[model samples]
Target: MNIAKHMETIFLASVVIVGATSMASAAVARIGHAAPEPKVYAVAVEGAPMAVVTVSAKRLSAAEKAAL
Candidate 1:
């Protein structure tokens, strides 16, 4: 029947599209996988003397924040 032929054509087209997309995605995946290995970088942090913190410190105003 004509309907069967049409259905066959649609199914074939969808299969072709899916196959093409899967191949393209596989190629893209391979290319994406070729990234350079990340090296561990050693950061030199200088030790700063820490002072004792107390709740007796005065709260700064908005003007103080802007100046700092």
Candidate 2:
């Protein structure tokens, strides 16, 4: 009986650890694929007017740009 109880405890602990690990990995995957927020900046040209520029957090490679 004692051995059975110990096995049950071990099984429950293993299940909990696996569940937590899966949840953490899922969250990381979502964050990895998430889009970055765009940044806005105000710029002033020499002897010119002010302008608003938007910068992307992520830059595309040449291949990615060509695919767009």
Candidate 3:
């Protein structure tokens, strides 16, 4: 019924819950039961910028020629 005792009980319960969760995680990792790898068709190179230019050199649009 005491406040101190109630807080102590709640703190002990939280410690036990966290310990159980950590133990479960360690067991799963030991058994190699982890998240599956994502399927990727292509891998992009690092620090490469992608550009999509659709304007022709000779047949440029009026807007594109003005912008250039």
Q: Count the backbone clashes (under 3 Å) in each candidate.
A: 0, 0, 0
As a whole number from 0 to 100, the lDDT of residue 53 in candidate 3 is 81
What tens digits encode model 1's per-residue C-alpha lDDT throughout 1-68?
A: 68776998989999999999999999999888687898978655679555567788888999999999
What's the alpha carbon RMSD for model 1? 10.3
**C-alpha lDDT of candidate 2 relative to the true structure:** 0.87
Task: Single out the weakest 10-residue window by summed lDDT for candidate 2.
Answer: 42-51
lDDT of 3 by residue, 1-68 (tens): 68786998899999999999999989888998668899998778889877578865588799998999
Candidate topping lDDT: 3
Go through the candidates in order and give the C-alpha RMSD of each one to the true structure. 10.3, 12.9, 11.3
Q: Give candidate 1's error at residue 12 in angstroms.
A: 0.2
**Where's the lowest-lDDT run of ten residues in candidate 3?**
48-57
What tens digits encode model 2's per-residue C-alpha lDDT throughout 1-68? 57776998989999999999999999999878777698768565689966669887998899999999
